[model samples]
Target: MAEQLLDVIVRKRELQGDGVVVLDLTRADGAALPLFDAGAHVDIHIAPGLVRQYSLCSDPADASVYRLGVLKDPASRGGSAGVHAHLLEGRQVQISAPRNLFPLAEGATRSILLGGGIGITPMIAMAYALEQRGDAFELHYCGRSRNHSAFLAELGSAPFASKVVTHFDDEHGRLDLAAVLGQGRARVHMYTCGPAGFMDWVIDGARQQGYAEDHIHKEYFQAEVDASGEGFEVVAARSGKTVQVAEGQSILQALTAVGIDIPISCEQGVCGSCLCDVLEGEPDHRDVYLTDDEKAGNDQILVCCSRAKSKKLVLDI
Candidate 1:
């Protein structure tokens, strides 16, 4: 099914840090926005054929508005730069309903939230929910420096300030991933979001410390994928059409070229919006959206970034 887009007005736009911007969005009609859980993200339609995902960082109890922290990525392909340049106060925009790929584990005795750089967005929201429930949780925010970290002042003065610890590379050298996950992993769930290197360290360190795979949660804002591969043929079963997926093009692109519109957002395959069933073929999975087990099954594939390993693939489009 297609995602639901809502009309929202940028109530306020404030610069949080060096290159970060905080946007407060509310329904254009002043109606209450849809409720979202911690670790949820919404798709912002920046322009025609351009969409980006930003995590919700506001308190879940507050239904007045949704907050997002966007970093002006220097390597962005017009998403972040466009947002920073075009979106202004009182400007109306369209955003999709919140969708969560990362959520706190239920029945956990304790929680540890890790955020690096702009990744602190979702962690702020999680802290609110945990504090309100009187749950045992700790939030550790890591950044290059205080001036580069968004929400530093607000987090310091927050009610859960006592449970927050910040590490700045410029001052503290580097966060010891070993020491953080050294705590016994009994009934505890750990969540981390950050740059690829930081997140890899956290995940690897946790695994080395014997943390259960199910107890570790993460979300990636972007993925490093090589979608270009050997050419192959895809047979669209329902459409009764066959198309050649070239070496430099993705399956989603090939299908769309043939007038088949498969729901797609975040073309990098992190959103799982272009996932489709595979009747017969081995997919060379390149997406981070699927679990290892799911990829091993070979019954489904995220066409946006993944490709076919076999000569021909039958898709249940």
Candidate 2:
């Protein structure tokens, strides 16, 4: 279905210690919002010039309200800063329907959740889902400090509190990566979301502890593209259109500039909403959203952040 941009009114705002601000929004038209699952996120149209993706931190069953937390990033590309500076209670915003790429698999024996900084957003919702199903799980949250952490109170009071471990880098030194992944548990699936460095540490440490790559899952909140050298061209098969995508302009942006409507959620390439089939040409595949096998098979490409390796490429879109 085509994405519908709905006007959402800010119901409330909460300062979750740290530079994070949680904004709760409800449909301005008072219509029923779409149901979402754990690990789901929505693309919020915060203003005329800004759009950002935030993981839903509220209960999925609470269809009447949508909740999101924004960290005031000083180095932000204007998105988070705009939300914090311009958004307030009772303000109106636009948001897309919920979309999920990091879905929990069914029939898992045990689950382990690791979150860092603001990456705790999706993990928070996963904790709720795991609790409702009475599943065996563990949640490890790491941050520079408790004051810089979001949702500390709710996480502390959650039913899974006993299993939740908080690590403050400032006081407790670096996270005890060895001890956490070395619990020697079998048949346990691990899910993580955090900064690239933190995620790298977790993934690398887990591998060192004999965890299979298939057993480890992760979600990255940011993507850094090194568009230093050159530009490329992308040809749309159906439209018979070719666009010169500069090093700074992503294929998705170029397509959109020419009035092609492509589904996109997280422009960072964490969400798989912008995935499209590649009829021909090699893709640079910079997105973390797709599995290695998926990329090797040339089945799909995340146009939002990925570019082309071939000088000329064709897209099924």
Candidate 3:
């Protein structure tokens, strides 16, 4: 992963609103960056062992630079704060190739994009792809206020501006979810990214309105996980080794302590980089990356932020 990282230079930085900042990065050697699809994200190596994932919000057709919209989180674990403080114009940085976890559904006749607050970043790129395909789509952006929303001017000036509807809590009151998603029809798909609570409301609304689970897509930046639990034994079947996972420790930490390495990014369980297969016991799934149906399968686990429910488990390793 280290050898695959691309060195980039920050071309510009723009303040979107109160706590939001947008960054434009280009190849340090004046070459075109790798082409990425809409809803793709790159892992930025902010500092040693400090990697964070951010979605690309720029137009996919243009390979000149990759744009990212970041919110300065007051409760950041150093990702957002570091970017706002040190990721300045002309600064060189390293980032991973783009990876997409929230891809658009193929052959959908209608698409609905719901972006809340800083979540509008990915939706902007998605809008570009949808418009280019000449597909019917609508973007509904909800924010606390106009001053707090990032990329308002850009969204308003976009060619698809007529298809965008914005709702501000301070101005337009609440966005009626029921009205926006009245009935889920065939060939209609929905995508959402934002706070967990807001996402839950939209997802529940969509489900109640007859939308299939596969037709609804979402991406979570972080999840509230309780990784602490009783100690257990993890058997690495391939390596022929066993490690005791102590209480208050994750499976990933325990394995790494014994020199078993698993590539990881976004330790909060959002990136799914450390996903591993389980051959034996049931896992207490705490990550939001896996859907409820996937959790029910119980064949795999996200070792980074998930613990075992069984006392002893066998890993495919």
Sort the predicted structures by TM-score, highest score first: 1, 3, 2
Per-candidate TM vs. native?
Answer: 0.96, 0.88, 0.94
- Across 113-179, the per-residue lDDT of candidate 2 in tens digits comes to 9998888889888988888888988889899987788888888887778888989988887888877
User: Which candidate do you rate higher for lDDT, 1 or 3?
Assistant: 3
Q: RMSD to the native, candidate 3?
A: 1.7
Each prediction's whole-model lDDT (CA): 0.90, 0.83, 0.91
- Please give the RMSD to the true structure for each candidate, in Å: 1.5, 2.6, 1.7
Worst 10 residues of 1 by lDDT: 177-186
Q: Write the per-residue lDDT of candidate 3 for residues 205-317, one digit (tens) a residue.
A: 99999999899999987677676679999998888889999988899998999888888877777888899999999998889888898899999999988888898889998
Residue 107's lDDT in candidate 3: 94
Candidate 3's TM-score reads: 0.94
Clash numbers, per candidate: 0, 0, 0
Candidate ranking (lDDT, best to worst): 3, 1, 2
Candidate 1: give its CA RMSD in angstroms. Answer: 1.5
- Quick one: best lDDT, which candidate? 3
Could you tell which candidate, 1 or 2, scores higher by TM-score?
1
What does the lDDT come to for candidate 2?
A: 0.83
Structure candidate 3, residue pairs in collision: none
